[model samples]
Target chain A: MYPANKYYVKGFVMSSYSERLNEYISMVNNELDRLLPEQRIPQQVVIDAMRYSLLSGGKRIRAVLVLEFCRMCGGDVAAALPIACAVEMLHCYSLIHDDLPCMDDDDLRRGRPSCHIAFGEANALLAGDGLLTLAFETILSSRNLAPEQIVKAAGVLSKAAGYQGMVGGQTVDLQNEGKPISGETLEYIHALKTGALIRAAVQMGCITAKADEGLCSGADEYAEKIGLSFQIIDDILDIVGFAQEMGKPVGSDRNNDKTTFATLYGVDKARQIVKTLNDEAKALLKRFPKANEFIYEFTDSLTSRTC
Target chain B: MYPANKYYVKGFVMSSYSERLNEYISMVNNELDRLLPEQRIPQQVVIDAMRYSLLSGGKRIRAVLVLEFCRMCGGDVAAALPIACAVEMLHCYSLIHDDLPCMDDDDLRRGRPSCHIAFGEANALLAGDGLLTLAFETILSSRNLAPEQIVKAAGVLSKAAGYQGMVGGQTVDLQNEGKPISGETLEYIHALKTGALIRAAVQMGCITAKADEGLCSGADEYAEKIGLSFQIIDDILDIVGFAQEMGKPVGSDRNNDKTTFATLYGVDKARQIVKTLNDEAKALLKRFPKANEFIYEFTDSLTSRTC
Candidate 1:
């Protein structure tokens, strides 16, 4: 499934990065399934809609980041797995809400119909609400983590997903859509809209691992850079990448008349920024002695990926 | 505002139930304002939308339940106040989503335009999401509560608000709309949709108070009965209550073609049931020696209120 890993694994003494990441992704998927299995109740439709969007295959980058960061911080990955899944759930909920007709209004996600298209708008809305609620439930219910850690992690997650974070970012994005916006405004949108959650994933991992302030800040800095680059790559891909690989149709930003890094800075400059951010992100990771070769390769891959 | 309470305040030795309840309501409103003040940022629109719906005055029944139950269980009201605000936030979030054009399609809430009507659909949707996320954040960020208790209370909240609880009930209610449904189905819907959170409010208060299981169970039983009666009263209100007092159009259930206890059982039977349930609910409160006369009056008031 991840055959490209063979070429990237040359310098790594441990198992290939793809293998480990795949294992974490699989763990997340299985845990999600177990946590939100289908039921035969009358309200099963909402659960089905939630699972449909939640289980749809994406890169699972957030989950991988969570587990990898925890592992890098010398934390128990097993205990961190639930937090990883929680971040993914939060991500999916945001995606579902963002695709609604009143928002981005995208009809497709992950190469399939968006949640509202697949499920009616009402159920899709409820599904998103359910997923968001379930994310907190997942964190609070997690075992092997201390109560203080769970509370801290859940608080971090809620703040990242709330008005001060992703929702705020989305609001500003919506307000600025179809209008010319400055590069600073674009960065602000991306920072809260995408960067906050990505940073939260790293922070939650560190919290679960009981990492010190120094280590946590370092991971957060690394995450912030990568988060920006990830969005920049997403912007670039929307303009130039293949629809099949990306799953959703390309040129969506243009269609929505929304500004992006590629649009605001031009594709050439955006590409350069991605490289710079990726390098800076990877450099920050070097501060963690325990962070293995896989983390570096993973960071590098984000800037170069076509999809 | 609560002149009627003067007539009912004769038997209470401490402050009148209305005064106590009003004080709790005021405390909740203040805390919510403090926690989610209007911000002057690009994302301020979303915050405004959130504050719009959140600050809209309702009966504050859930907040009162949290504070009153905590007080009855010998918990510090100040410590429990945050949880009270959290429940109200959760309730408001649900109300916002439920009133969306996609869901209940309500244009009016609390005598004014619904969140979606005032803010555009997109911002309203985000406001609902924001509030829901903030609810958990409020609970997790609550000071003075033990970590274990906070986790337990938050877990209870997330479950009540998630797919298996309020969302599930909403889904089923939506599915059954315009379709003939039995009394059993209505009971199930009311239980999850309204009963779950009401029960959670009581349970959260008990958990915060470190109330024993016996007390929790007794309180839960009281809550469950009132919850059902509360819904039954809502159904009745939709049929016969004054729009000016109810703060929304009457006969919406009939307009939406929704089946309710008032429709399923004739108004007289429904009225009788409310009385029975209210009495039973008040009877359960007798097990709590620490519970004050305010609780008993509060229980009886739900069945008799016009709004």
Candidate 2:
């Protein structure tokens, strides 16, 4: 599950935090659009499918984490921009594959027809494959990073996205559908399914900034807290949030009989857990030498988001 | 359209070239087995699926190209073994995806149930995802190469595997199924779908060897000729090859009403083209200063295979 757009909450007002978030979102969106491959003859549809899902607007939270963490670690945001986009590309690929008929079979994503629905199943499959491969291609294309740094960053990403991480988690999740799973099993699934990539995002930013080992460890711990909280928020939203804001049907988790935090512990307890985890995440951020007020607000804002 | 097992062909006897090729295959298989992820909790099935396809026996020609080119360019074979396995991992992933029901819908691979048929569509899909991501992880995990060389080799691989290459060619191949297509389009498809990775295998080898640009270019030219001939041979095999030796059913291309070199140019003419192209490829190899007698014999052996 990913964070949704909260800019249009009923009583929300644009603050400096909102403005900076918007700026980061715009920068990432522009770069993603610029980096998308041109539609060459005979293979234009595959490229079109890739662009359609990639450019479809979301909050760009994963990408923002990469840039904001880099900035927090005293790294050049421009230098980390490609890495930021790479994570987003990888995330988009997961979403596409997760929506396939043989998988979750979802008909929509971010309030639009899913990749398989918009493009036929075959092209959609290839689109996911393309995006996954392109994620690595994008990372290696970064001109500002040293080759060592690039290799390290790619290793982090590939581990997060590979069999031991996201794909492995998805396999378990699908296999357990409609079965009674324990709390520990659920946690393991979420930790690998989503937590791994979030941790990689923070760690990659630190590596790009040449942060110390201790700082990387601290950052990873912070990422773990926020990533879990993010998932809890997602479960809560599925039960109580608006479809218009959430960009997908509400209560689909319950409809599918999925065992989420809300289903296991109830929404109130899940909210409590999110608050505690996010607070700890923000507190952990304070240990970083270059952490700033904007970073604090950004970390806290996810806890209060309705969408 | 990979090269089939030729060592077991009637009247074929083990020679120095075969012995060395077998040695390379055994090394790659051992390394791949060692590198495969342990069967972790709740995710064991995905790993099983990944291993099932990857360890299925093939000639390992693409991987051999990586190692042989590295050797031909005077590089350490041990240092490049991981790269060789990386290309093999990538090839296996592509085959898994290509056999999916939403794609080519084949029910068999390497004389067994295809990945989707063996593991179910969803797990097979994740298995392919796992292998593709693992390919990059395997490359970066190498400790023998310089960081720059690793980065360069990874870049070559990602480009060959991504939208502009393998995936793009697959898209066109699927779109043109059961339809009339020109020779130019057929060439375009084969060049990207198969040739790109073959070219990358050679290029990555040269990069690992620190070969000069002149030698890299010549290696690439040789790879191109052999790669094209490889496809033409595949088409020829589809028409005349034995199912027992070819592993999958022969003439399935015709069964599926697919356009192929044999269909477009006739088997005799396709064979003639293969002979001419392979001769040119072998002659080009003679230009590499360290190219050995075994390398030439190996190249020629492919042209005369019956499987």
Candidate 3:
């Protein structure tokens, strides 16, 4: 999951960048909690089911990426919060459905009972649907953003979550479960399944900032590289990371006979490819002459993570 | 399901309205077909499965309502087509998910295989997810609509599809299944499950026309009453209508021990309630000052049926 002790030493350094990222995550979580209220409903069970998987505690990477990218593009973080919350909501929906008996059929999610396991299968399905609809609601609730910006942002999100992006990726993933997939096909699957949302995150930031089209396209390219690299590293972690450390079952992919980068290409080759992609991602950011420090540090932190 | 012999006379006379409705449905189907291209990909089977359900014949009542309501409110039908298409997409998603093996688990829909039965369980689930995501895509594609109108329409659709609407109704319906339900509870379920989308259709029409809030709200009230009345009449039909007339099994509600209006209030009382609600719906529209012929005819058509 990480490159040896690099993150260990970085953690010991108490860097200002790390502190700021932590602060941003905290704020995003606070906003998310406020937005998804569990106390206002008559059926406490349904609300609890929603909160269970929602608050199970992941890295909050999507939300942070949205906020940090907006900040790096010289946009107000406050204006980006709704989109950030939306990104997480979309992510949560994916996870909820992924854990369904018809899908991944996993009993545990984030070391707790999956939504379907906690609530009934029916409620889990509704909870996921609710969250998906709520994501659009959050984006539409961006009262602070310009109407044009909101439209653009909604477009990005819809494309990412729709047939061409995450759902398409998932469709391909499910179809190719027991079959041997070519390297190219696997890459296409990962690009849609995982890379699309990440790309949208960067584009959302630029659009929210009302950045020029050239810069927006540049950020997209950068996001594309980093997103694929992130997935490749995740594939590697499935093989080497411990279950306790990852908070998810290790080697579940291998057990399911699912296609992964490590399965198609050896670990060393996958690692080398991710490194090359990382370099390309950094190079793409060169077009932004006045890039913020957080951008560089965030990119570095992503490629250098250890679990 | 129309009453026998009644169709022989009225069908010929109402052919013009049916033709207009068919033209509108054809436009929606064409748009959906164009959006979902049939190509051989790994996910083609799942895409086809979703297309099968979508293309299967139905009344397209929601889309027609959107178009007619827009026309009645003095808006271009062309401008409302995207929102109209969106309502169908949302409705299609609900049907696909509702037919899942974990949900309703029906073998047939619209005289064809259900999504799960045609596709595998996983792909069926993903197909539903894909359809839901695509609903937003369809709505967001309304680039011709003004930004404020787009925002308003999106808000209305989202609210109708979310917790306070369809999902909540489904949850309550699931919980109340096979149990004795009060007339009020049944009404509540029908209102949220069916009425919400019906109300949204009228609201979308008014907002797209940039009509005053009073007019929109009045139309929505009109829609809500009719929507509930529609469902109550449906329950009445399920108990008394024949399989040949309805094109599906009848008395399945009693066999399934479902607590529908007829089960809760007796068939005669349910029919009477439908009449009352239809009257109430027509009364609400009196506030519109000048009613179009379509509005009057549509409202009259709802409760006047004798299947």
> Which candidate achieves the best TM-score against the true structure?
1
What's the CA error at residue A149 for candidate 3, in Å? 1.1
Which runs of model 1 end up more than 4 angstroms from their true locations?
A1-12, B1-12
Error of 1 at A202 (Å): 0.4
lDDT of 2 at A60: 85
Predict model 2's lDDT versus the native.
Answer: 0.88
Write out the backbone clash pairs for model 1: none
lDDT of 1 by residue, A83-180 (tens): 98899999999999999999988898988999999999999999999999899999999887999999999999999999889999999999998998
Alpha-carbon DockQ of candidate 2: 0.83
Better of 1 and 3 by TM-score: 1
Give lDDT tens digits, candidate 2, residues A110-154: 999999999999999999999999999999988889999999999
Q: For candidate 2, lDDT tens digit of each residue in B85-145?
A: 9999999999999999999999999999999999999999999999999999999988889
In candidate 2 the C-alpha lDDT for residue B216 amounts to 96
lDDT of 3 by residue, A1-307 (tens): 2122321112213557777677667776777788778765433455567677777778887787777667666777778888988888888989899889888788878787889988989889988888888888888878778877887898899999987888888888877888899988889898998999999888997877788888888899999999999998888888887787666789999898877998889788888888899889888888876565666777877777533
TM-score of chain B of each: 0.95, 0.94, 0.89
Residue ranges of candidate 2 with Cα displaced over 4 Å:
A1-15, B1-15
Proportion of native contacts kept per candidate: 1.00, 0.92, 0.58
- Candidate 3 Cα outliers beyond 4 Å, as residue runs: A1-15, A40-43, B1-15, B244-248, B287-290, B304-306
By DockQ, the better pick of 2 and 3 is 2
Better of 1 and 3 by lDDT: 1
Candidate 3 lDDT tens digits, B1-307:
2122421112223556556556667777877787777978766876887788777777777887887667666677777878887888888888888877767666667766787888878887788888888888877878668877887788788888887788778878877778888877887887878999999988998887788878888888888888988898778888888766554577777887998888788888888888888888778777765455556667777776644
Q: After superposition, how far is residue B148 of candidate 3 from its true place, in Å?
A: 1.0
